[model samples]
Every structure is written in structure tokens, then in C-alpha cells.
Target chain A: MARQKMGGFNAGSMADIAFLLLIFFLVTTTMDTDSGISRKLPPMPEKDQEKSNDKIKERNVFVVLINKNNQLLVEGEPMDVRLLKDKAKEFIDNPANNPKLPEKKITDIDGKYFGHTYFVSKGVISLQNDRGTSYGTYIQVQNELAAAYNELRNGLAMRTFGEKYKELSESKQKLIKKVFPQRISEAEPKNVGGGK
Target chain B: MSKFRTKKDKGTPPISTASLPDIVFMLLFFFMVSTTMRQQDLKIRVHVPAASEIQKLEKKSLVSYIYVGSPLQQYQKIFGTEPRIQLNDAFATTNDIRDYITSEREARDEKEVPYMTTSLKVDEYTKMGVVTDIKQALRKCNALKINYSTRMLSSE
Candidate 1:
């Protein structure tokens, strides 16, 4: 019997298979990266612990209240949301050493992070919002407050190490965070009218 | 000039497409490496708020998403226009958050439980009352590490 010579398989359909895979991946995968503002909530208090009202100085507390209408009442004065960052920075840094501003405590820094001691602010930003406030406004306020802290840390990092805060080593970043700890305390939400 | 003139009878040669499949396969591999498969279909219409101070969440496997928004057009008739919370594939109430957290923790490695993060993707126009309730539920369950999922604000 005489056998026919074998020919190469056609390769034209290879492109079609690749196209099918590409389309499948394009439809199944999401290109958007997830990002957000990270926060750690305070742990639940024990039932047995006494509810002691530890007194905090009025000057050290920066009260930021958002009413039901989404209007800001910062330290009892009506202000715009756009200006909240500068106000927060001023309160945290107290650069002018104003008598009414938060007091600074002289903290001893370990030689590992810094050779000399630094002055750490004792400011605590107390944020209270009404239940009727819009979620957008709430996040805006939180973002502005976080931006204030980041800017202060960046400035200090630049002056001290000539590098950005994010670029610093983890321990060194912790040292800088010690200088300006993000002390935003959120109070429980309250019903302030204008709600169903 | 005559040397450069082409013969009229000999038409232009057809370009070879031997590399076309290779190029397409390269694109397919790139998409497979860089992007992640969508985990679930969204029942709520969520338009996350924007912010400048935001951080990219690391370790996608460790994150548990909590979506808060009004129901889509099809579900609006049954669910009403009010904002609702969605966990995994179904609508959930604030009280369901604790159970959700427990199940999420149980599904992962014990060592990774501490590093687990709960991401709240809330719509911008929704009221804060629902968000606060969710927060309280999370706190009760001892899931303290939370992220308010927001997009990058272009203004900078």
C-alpha cells in the first residue's frame, strides 16, 4: 500500500483562540484599584469599668460640630468646609504659641529615632456630627482633618530628614507620628432634628 | 528613478500575520497579571465619595467589603428608596454585620484575622445614620480595623 505524505496543520485559527481568551479576561477582570481612608475604631469598653468623666481642658479640645443642615460650627463659630484644613493645622501645631491654643509637652525622644527631645502637641480634635448629616459631608470633614495631619508630618519630615514622611523608615515615621498623633475622637451620633 | 519603479504585473506581497496571535497572547497575559476578577455583582448603586487623603488597600484577599447605598431600579420597588446595606451577595441589616464579621474571620487563616480589614463603600448622598449604625455593629463584633472606601479627588 502507498501512504500519502503528511502536511503541517493549519495555524490560521490560532489568532481566533487568542482573541477568545482576551475577550474572556476583559469581561471578567476589573481594572479599578480599591483605595480608601484607613481608620481604627476604639475597642468596646468593658461593662465593669466605671464611666469616669475624665476632665479635658477646654483649650486643648477643638470641637468641630456638623449640624443637621450640614453646616459647620467650629469651636462655636460658623465656618466653611474649605477652610477646615488650615484651622485644624493651626490648632494642631500652635506655631504662634497662642495662649488659647493647645499646650505642648516636652517629650524625650530615644536616640534610635532622634538625638534630641521634641515638643509634642496635646491637641485633641473632637468631631461630632448629627444623624441627619449627609455621608458626603462627613467624609469631606474626615478627609480634611486627615490632610491636616499629613501636611504637618510632611513639613516636619522635610525639615528634619530632608525627605517626605512616607519615604522615611517605619520607626522614624512612628517617631514623627508621635510628634503629631492623629487624635481625632469621634463622639456617638446624636439625633439633631430634621430627620424622619 | 527607473530602478525604483515596481513591476505592474507583480502585485504587492501580502503581509504575514504569523505574529498576530503572539501579540494577542501577550495582551491576554498582561490583563491576567494586572487585573483581578470581579468578586460579586453589586445590588446597590454605590458612588463612593472622593477624598485627597486616601491609601491603597493592600492584600485584596484579606479585605471584606460592605456596600451601603440605595437599591437599583429593579429592587427599588421592593426595597424602597431608603439606603440599604449589602454584604456579599444579599441585602443585610445592621444587625447582620456581626455575623458577617464572624464568618469572614472564620474563612481566613487564624494569623490573618488580625490583619483583616473591613472596607465600607458608601454612596455619597446616603445619610450618616445608616453608616453610624454599621460602625457600631462593627465595634460590637471587635472588628475595629475599617476603611472608608473613597476615590482620589482630582483637585489635589
Candidate 2:
């Protein structure tokens, strides 16, 4: 037999094969940017302590309850979610600036030290949800509440710093945060199966 | 002068496709580097909700995922159809969260420990009870930075 020969395999088809696979992945995979409703969670409870109502005055409290039936109860009255942001803003700004409202204007001395002391810490948003509340309604309410705070901060940031809230310097951002702190105190979930 | 110029090889050699495979290979390697294959075989069904205000979790490594959804048909025999929380690969319960977070924190780069966040991949139809429990667990551990993993609503 003649000396054995080692033959080379043609590599020209390699690019065509790779292109086919590339096309497959290009069509099949979805390059999605993950996003969400960002909110700061409350600290853990030390114990099963009953929440005291005396600390936060009635005017400063914006109570929002979402029940199993997907209905919203603001303070004590039933309300549509579309109006939540405005109502929250009104309560926070208290545009009425009623003396009974717990909001306090910044004193010149306080204003000098702190750039934007719009409202005091008494402004609390207590969100309570049922165990059965669907995540959709829960998130929608959370988004609206967060939006309320964001709008407040943005408005003040603009007036005080002449910049949007997110665009402000770090120190300025801290000052803004002190004024419009997000006090969304989430109570323990209550009633789990109405999960529609 | 034209006759003396020796006809300048008009054929032009087919644009030298010798580098075609090399270019395609380069693209293939790029996609290979950038693409992350399914991190794990999802044993559960997760349909995250959509919202108007959204923010991307900055670093994938700094965030630990908590998947909450019902088991798939294959896992139904073991985990049942009820909505459950998953940590890494195994089907876990609310109680497992603390230890899981700790271990995951320990497994990361030492300096990155402080920036750890819990990304809750919760299904839209799921009840708030489980998500709340997980949140509370995260809070108790002081792993409070949370990313409620959500998709953007197609509308502005």
C-alpha cells in the first residue's frame, strides 16, 4: 500500500455555519433591560409590638389600605388610584397650609443650615395590604405613592438647588432627602388567597 | 505608455475573503462573551409585573435573586403547584431566606458585601403574603436594598 496521506478538512463552511447559529440566537433571545418600582423597605420589627397611633398626628398620616377585593381605602374613605398622587401631594404640601395640618415651614435659621426643609418628619404614608392582594394592585399603589414623594422632592430640588432631584449634588441630595424623607411605613400583610 | 505599463492585473482578486472566517469568528466570540445562558433551569414559573417607574439593578453580582412563583409541571410532583420562593437552585421556604442571604453574602467579594441587594422576582398574580414575608426576612437581616424586578410598561 502507498504511504498513508493525512488530508485537511475544508474550513470554508465554518462561517456559514456560525452565521446560521448567530441568526438563531439573535431571533430567539430578548435583550431586556430589567426595571422596577424602587422603594425603600421599612426596618424589621423588634417584636410583635402593637403600632402606637399617638406619635403621628391625624393630619400628618396618609393611610392607604389595599384589600383583597382590589379596592383602595385612603384614610377611611374609598378612593380611586388615579387620584392618589394628587391627594398625597396635597396632603404633603398641604397647599391649603391649614394650621391644623402638621406641616411646618422652614425657619430662616433652619433654611440656612438645611437647603430644602419643606416638610417635617410627621408626614407619614402608612401602606397596609391584604395577604390576598394581587401583586399588580400592590405595585400600582406603591408606584403612585413613590411617585408622590418623587414629585415633591423634584419640585423642592428645583426651587432650592435649581436642579432636578436626581441631578443635584450628593450633599444637596442628602439635604433634600432630610426634608422629604420617604416615610412609607408598610404594615404587615393581612388577609393571602384573593390572588387574582 | 499604456502598452509599456503591462496591463496592471485588472482581475482584482475577489476582494480577499480570507479574513471572512476571522471576522465571523470575532463576532461569534463577542456574542459568546456577552451572552449569559439561562443561569439556571427554571423549575418555577415567574411572570414579573410591569410598572411606569423603573430602575435597573446596577450590578448582577451585588444582587441576590428571590424567585417566587408556582412550580412547573415537571416539579409539581415535588414542590406542588403552590407559589413558592426559590433561592439559587433549590425550592426554598420563607425561613430559608436568612441563611441563604448570609451564605450568598459570604460567597461574594469581601468589599461588595455592603452593597448587597435582594431582587424579588415575584409573579404578578402571586399573593402579597409570600413577598411580604421575604421582604421582612430581608429587613430582619438588614438586607434592605430591594429591587422589585419589574418590566417597563410599553407606554410612556
User: In TM-score terms, which candidate is top?
Assistant: 1
| Model 1 agreement with the true structure over A78-156: per-residue lDDT tens digits | 9999999999999999999998999998888666555657778899999999888989999999999999999999998
lDDT of 1 at A6: 52
Candidate 1: the clashing residue pairs are none
Clashing pairs in 2: A131-A191, A131-A192
> Cα lDDT for residue A182, model 2?
80
Q: Report model 1's TM-score to 2 decimal places.
A: 0.93
The TM-score measured for candidate 2 stands at: 0.80
Which candidate comes out best when scored by DockQ? 1
Model 1 gets an lDDT of: 0.93
Task: Give a tens-digit lDDT track for model 1, residues B1-156.
Answer: 555565544787777777889999999999999999998889999999999999999999999999999999999999998999999999999989999999999999999999999999999999989999999999999999999999999998
Q: TM per model?
A: 0.93, 0.80
lDDT of each: 0.93, 0.79
Each candidate's chain B TM-score? 0.90, 0.82
